[model samples]
Target: MVRKKGVYGIAIVALICFLLIVFCTKEPDTVRISHNFQAIEFEDVDVIGEDISIDKIIDTQRLRLERKFDVFKFVTNKTFNKLSMLSGGQPLRTIIVTTWRSGSTFLGDVLNSLPGNYYHYEPLLHYGIMQIRGPPHADTAIKTLKNLLNCDYTDLENYLTFGMSHIYLFTHNKRLWTQCEAYPQYCWNATFLNEFCRLFPFQSMKVVRVRLRLIEELLSDKRLNTKVILLVRDPRGTLQSRRHRDWCPGEPDCDRPDLLCADMVSDYSAAIKFNKMYSRRFRTLRYEDLSLSPYKVVQDLFDWIGINVHPEIKEFLDTHTTVNVGGVSSTYRDSKNVPFHWKNDLNYTEIQSIEATCEEAMKLWGYVKTKGPKLRDFNPLTSYTIK
Candidate 1:
């Protein structure tokens, strides 16, 4: 009887090991590719070099494990949620907060590619440019933003009537304008507002010119239901790009790299504070990370924002994000190459100047300072593909 018991125990142990191996080696389930998926074909030689596999692009083991977990969780949760249709009344309101030259435009464009998206670009920019005391004013700006969230144009129209051309330039949507053209005053009226609100429930605003402190204050307001995407770039990269654009080349304070670095430190400090206060509602996106893996980064971002990664968006990234600067006949640069270009553009002194003030901020945001011109580790050249 004892000998039989030992044999049974050994068989059970062997069975458990066999089951573990089977489960561990099994391939993860793949989501069916929707017919709506679009592929963007590009002829640019610079953008079309040896294709990097998506697996190679996402080399971080931690990130890969998280993504794997997310896939299982996402599938299960999504299947459960599909039992009932989600309502448009409670659409996700997103605020993309960033500083100048932080690639907010690129990120915004990707988010805006989603259907039924109402995008307002830099609504507070006019306030800064016009020296208007209201738009950036916490209460006033918050009120205007609330109206936008509710899809109301009454207050926005009144504000624009003050000859705020800059406001019009940024906030105006050509498609909406065309749709409202037949309406009185070209659909800048109540009926048009109602229809616009009904048609496009999801709203997004990308703000770059606003102060981070004011944004924090606005978000702190419980009445405003919005998620903030704090988009950040390495100070070295942002400053180098700004220098290329001559955005503050002539201004003495702006020309001083140290001052800019200090400002970046302040900005990132505010970001860290805001994130701490609103961890769930506030998500941060780094330009460097996004550049290295656009599809993966975007997938994770969309998942975090309670949305599914749509196929059209993937196509949009391929088509719009990868392109040459000007006289765009064929030549184009891959979007992945956008990050770390500062390495080539900025000199040692410039990088060091940025590092002096932004060291803590850089570390806080997962930016590692290089000992030399380039990072010895973390090579982006890897084979990967996202289907």
Candidate 2:
């Protein structure tokens, strides 16, 4: 009986040891790890171990692992809400917000052309897409961008727009995703969007291209010492240019021209309203001024940004400043010698139609009324073609 009892006790001890081993071997379901300016989240971790310190995993391999984990977190969350929270919320240097087709792209391209400037064209679009589809989509966007540019991130970062450069230019698309009825939830979530914008205010300059409507939001960022460049053009010309783009309304190529027109009008009205509200903040310039006096405008812009034009930049400007009408392949046409094309291109009827369609916008922007013989009728269909 004594021997049997001893054997039973040993068996019980073995069972307890087995259970302990099993418990120790089980992996954690989630682990939150943070490192320099970033936090990594790991889910479904298989190894059950004591919590690891970020300091202990500061090497290259660990950093790569952390990045992978971050990608996973981004996918799961489908938002960049936590990015600002990491690194004690480091602020971004600059944010350049603008409406689409308002020479923002040209400005971005020009800024990026300058050395030592980081100009990201439409980064918010990528960010928005990432927010919608998660990390895989973000990765795909990055990869596609890299491929389209025919350069890797390392090479691209050398220029002023791809990475954390000293000078950053961000051209944010003004159209909120929520406007699309199909994806109301994807519209700019103020919390996340504000957080994203707030992350970059520490820079030396935040040059914002303020359309009339978004000035309020631009003003709300008290941290940002905003320099507003209010860009304006004739509503008729604006619509004409807009219609020429493949993405514009009334384009035969567009799947829904009616919706595009409504959206454009809404956007134009918002711009007009914004301009009225923040007229004092703006250094208003006509699109014609930029075209006719490229050098003067560019020099003035440089002064505003507090950058001395390097000799190389000046030389490039001197060569490229002349107006190259009829697309990029055309020869430089001296603005002084060339007659204004609008006089011939825009008929009386077309002008009146444009005025009628965007009278509020024109009045808000301080456009002067012109006297002319009224033409019989205006047909926008004949004036512009979608490329």
Candidate 3:
């Protein structure tokens, strides 16, 4: 009985010492920004157009917990954020500035395929929807996009439910809740979801619905810490693809030279203008170049984002790259056939109209006019060479 009593007393004493050490340790009370960009603050006005209360849309519990954690860690550990960067686990927010039928789907797929990465697809779809009280302004879209990059869906929840407002943060094919049902392992674990939320290397958004005029406003905001990949396609190809798919229902006839082609030119001009101002954060990619040399192209893109291609992403591309040639709904074709499909599919007048409308962009992007049914051979076997 005496021995038992002594052992119990020792156990209590050891537990006390452990508790004291944990509470007394003094860590530096400063959390440094992991990256070199400035943090941005959102505007006071409600970004969502709905009349509902903000709390209804926001997951207040999650936001509060995140803010509290950020404050607590900032006060307790100076080295915490630095360690995240050093370990190559720092959050990287990326926005792929693109338009419809411009190969953004494939690129978004590649980005989303990367483990620990998130992809938001066309979050600006709410702009055209009438069910929403008002069209989403550039400022509102930019604000919502930035919030999503940080995993804050506060103002975006209501917008995602209405008319043409189907913004996809993960996959467009599957609803947000059904994502886990389709891919179980990729689903968030309730226990570690918070930790998982904080550990991603990339949070990407691909926008095709927003106006090109918004590029400056969106990219100029340094708080976003976003790299904009201005993706362009040969206007001839873009028009042909759009017409074939008829994806944008509200737009005028795509075949009308003034419609799709003019929009393409405007977007390209915006990209060019912004590239001049924010040369460091802006990059322009052409579908022709990407199709001909996807491996080299994405390698450069991945380098711009400061990450090597994830092996699984590479493998996924290897299989999917050749599966669909024209668009998501189109039939499977040789991967090399993608860039040259315009050669066979588009006739002389159609090509001429697109070329005339997109003359400046074609020249700017180095898309030389070719006049042959014969396609230059491109070997898909050389697809993604991992260095």
**Which predicted model would earn the best TM-score?**
1
In the range 326-374, model 3's lDDT, one tens digit per residue, is 4455323345567566766777776766667766556656666545434
Every candidate's lDDT: 0.58, 0.39, 0.55
lDDT of 2 by residue, 127-211 (tens): 3211212344444443433321221233232222331231122222211111111122322233333322233212222222222
Query: Comparing candidate 2 with candidate 3, which one achieves the higher TM-score?
Result: 3
- TM-score between model 1 and native: 0.64
Rate residue 25 of model 1 by lDDT.
Answer: 98
TM-score of model 2 vs. true structure: 0.43
Backbone clashes for every candidate come to 6, 13, 0
Rank list by lDDT:
1, 3, 2
Segments in model 3 whose C-alpha atoms lie over 4 Å from true places: 1-90, 128-136, 163-199, 246-250, 253-255, 323-327, 330-333, 370-387
Encode model 1's per-residue lDDT on 283-310: one tens digit a residue.
Answer: 7677777777888898988877776665
Predicted structure 3, TM vs. truth: 0.63
What residue runs in model 2 are displaced by over 4 Å at the alpha carbon? Answer: 1-100, 124-212, 222-226, 251-282, 323-340, 373-387
Candidate 1 accuracy as lDDT:
0.58
Q: Which window of ten consecutive residues has the lowest lDDT sum in model 3?
A: 35-44
